[model samples]
Target: MSEAHEARISRNEEDIQDIWKVVEDIKKVLAARPPLWCTFLLMALSSGLTGFIVRAFS
Candidate 1:
């Protein structure tokens, strides 16, 4: 492949790695902060929506 293609692929890989690191940092922050009732409420809502979508399509 060309140098330009290789450079772009390298940049894409670096960007993905940076994003994953940010996600891990956010998880650590959340774990330390430990949101109270609101987090549980949101989690329940997310699970309910997921179940609803699965049942609807299935």
Candidate 2:
């Protein structure tokens, strides 16, 4: 291949790698949220139950 062609391929490869890293970082952030939501949901349910019990006891 010509030198220009090789240079273009290398640049394209670097761009792809950079994009892949960004995608991976985004994936990591996305993957880390479900458990947090589950915890929040559990806390909300517990608080609601406590409120219900208090009202019932009153």
**Highest-scoring model, TM-score:** 1
Work out the TM-score per prediction: 0.60, 0.57
lDDT of 1 at 3: 100
Q: In model 1, how many backbone clashes occur?
A: 0
Question: Model 1 residue 32 lDDT?
Answer: 79
TM-score of 2: 0.57
* lDDT (C-alpha) at residue 56 in model 2: 100
Instruction: Itemize residue pairs with steric clashes in candidate 1.
Output: none
Candidate 2 lDDT tens digits, 1-58: 9999999999999999999999998778768897887788799999999999999999
Write the residue-wise lDDT of candidate 1 on 1-58 in tens digits. Answer: 9999999999999999999999999788777777765688799999999999999999
* RMSD (Å) per prediction: 4.4, 11.8
Task: Check candidate 2 and list the clashing pairs.
Answer: none
RMSD of 1: 4.4
Q: Model-by-model lDDT, in order?
A: 0.91, 0.92
